[model samples]
Target: MLCGCVGLVWLYEGDVEVAVYLIWLALVFDFLDGFVARLLRVHSPMGKELDSLADLITFGVLPSFILYKMLQQQEVDAWVPYLAFLVAVFSAIRLAKFNIDENQQTVFIGLPTPANAIFISSLIFVDGSYPSLLSYPVLLIITILFSYLLVSPMELFALKFKDFGWKGNEVRFSFILFSALSLLFFLHLALPMIVMMYILLSFFVKIISTT
Candidate 1:
């Protein structure tokens, strides 16, 4: 949470790239906290709530701050930057749903907050390679679309490694392999593409299992 606060400060001060990096660092810590807790068999309700709170700031608020800054940097209409907060609102809804939704054990019923954050940040990491993204109209559309995606009913596979065997871990393994290739080929742009690929691969897995 402290790191996220600092990142938010950096974002407002016009140090966007550093802010994005800090958010990513926060992600590493977030993952480790959960991992270490599970490794030690210490799952508590308080821990879960704390995780959500940290995520709300690191993944939810920080990403929106980045988007708001990017939009502002682009010199778009005044109203456009505020639309970025929609991401945080939807992320909160998604996190609350996850806490109560027993159905989402190994798979999520919408885009995960961290993935959405990475997707939004990765576009800016490209350093203005995609000029269309800077357009106010385009940013608004993306903001709304991502907000909806955060609460969508689509099943997205979680990247957790449940087993070492390939039989049940095929999707996770394939995703990692392809993600590596995507980064090799597309560089920073691959981060967003990998999120899109995650959705497509989930559908493919579902179809193949049914057939």
Candidate 2:
């Protein structure tokens, strides 16, 4: 959560790049929380609850702040920027469902908060390169679209690996390869692309599975 707090500070300081990097760092730690818990064979309701709280701050609130600041920067109407908080609101609902939904063990029922955070935070680069692409209207649309996606009934795949083998993991491996190459070739520009690729890849996998 410190990373998230620091990100908010940097964001307020007008250092958006640093704030975005912090969000990425927080995501890494978020993944580690689960991995370490499993590694130590220590699992409890308290730990799970704490994990969700940390996620709310890092993935939910931090990203919303970033989006809020972005909209504010656009100099839109006074109350319009407040809409960015919808990301946090929907994120909380998504996380709450995740905690109780047993069907989400190997797949997500909607866009995961972390992925949503990454997609929103990565928009900083788009704003940097193509200022017109993220105008007030566009950002508002993104806010509403993603807010709905957070709680929508989209079946997104999880990156959990039962084994490192090739069989039964074709889609996962392909996704990893695509993400790696995108990052290698595009750098920060790949952040949002990777998230989009993840969603499309999940849909593709589902289609092939039902055939």
Candidate 3:
């Protein structure tokens, strides 16, 4: 809740970097809330529902707000703002599916809400350096692509810790290692690239495992 408020302030201030960091902070809180819940053996149906609702606000609504800000700056067509709502709707669907799906106990069936949020936030975070890339047409296409990923069937996103010593976990471990290195080197600017890479890497891993 505090993180969400901070993000809202950053949004109003037009500080995309701070807003992105606040989104990341929300992600940390999201993780800790679940961790503490489990450690305290206080997990309940209401807690689960509450977490999802919090996520909807932090990840879904906040990202859309950031994207809307970006589009406003670009003087994008008035209709472009509607695409931001697509993210929120798709995120709601993703969270609802996660709640009911037995297969998502250990892994996600589609892109997670936090990832989607980070992806959108990163676009604003690096907007100046990637001016040509952040144009309305490109952003529109990306918005559509990410919305598709939110419900994409072939994606198998992981939510649990991979066993470090396990043979089959090598890809997961390597991906995490590379992601950490990317963050270390590029800070927030690397977020979107690393996330896209992770999605592609997961696809190949799934293909190999299935074979």
Candidate lDDT values, in order:
0.85, 0.90, 0.81
Which of candidates 2 and 3 reaches a greater lDDT? 2
Which candidate tops TM-score? 2
**Regions of candidate 2 where Cα sits further than 4 Å from its true position:** none
Candidate 2 clashing pairs, residues 3+ apart or interchain: none
lDDT minimum window of 10 residues, candidate 3? 155-164
Number of colliding residue pairs in model 3? 0
Per residue, candidate 3 scores C-alpha lDDT tens digits across 72-182 of: 777767877777788888889988888888887666788999988889988865786778778888878877888889888866657466455757666677878888999
lDDT of 1 by residue, 106-144 (tens): 899988898888888887856468776557777777789
| Candidate 2 lDDT over residue span 1-211, tens digit each | 8988898899889898898899899989989888998789999988878788888888999899988988888877889889999999999999899888889988999999999999999999988887988889899999999999999998989999999999988889999999999999998889889998998888888788889
Q: Could you estimate the TM-score for every candidate? A: 0.92, 0.95, 0.91
Clashing pairs in 1: none
Question: Candidates sorted by lDDT, descending order?
Answer: 2, 1, 3
- Rank all candidate structures by their TM-score, best first, as comma-separated numbers: 2, 1, 3
Question: Candidate 2 — worst ten consecutive residues by lDDT sum?
Answer: 46-55
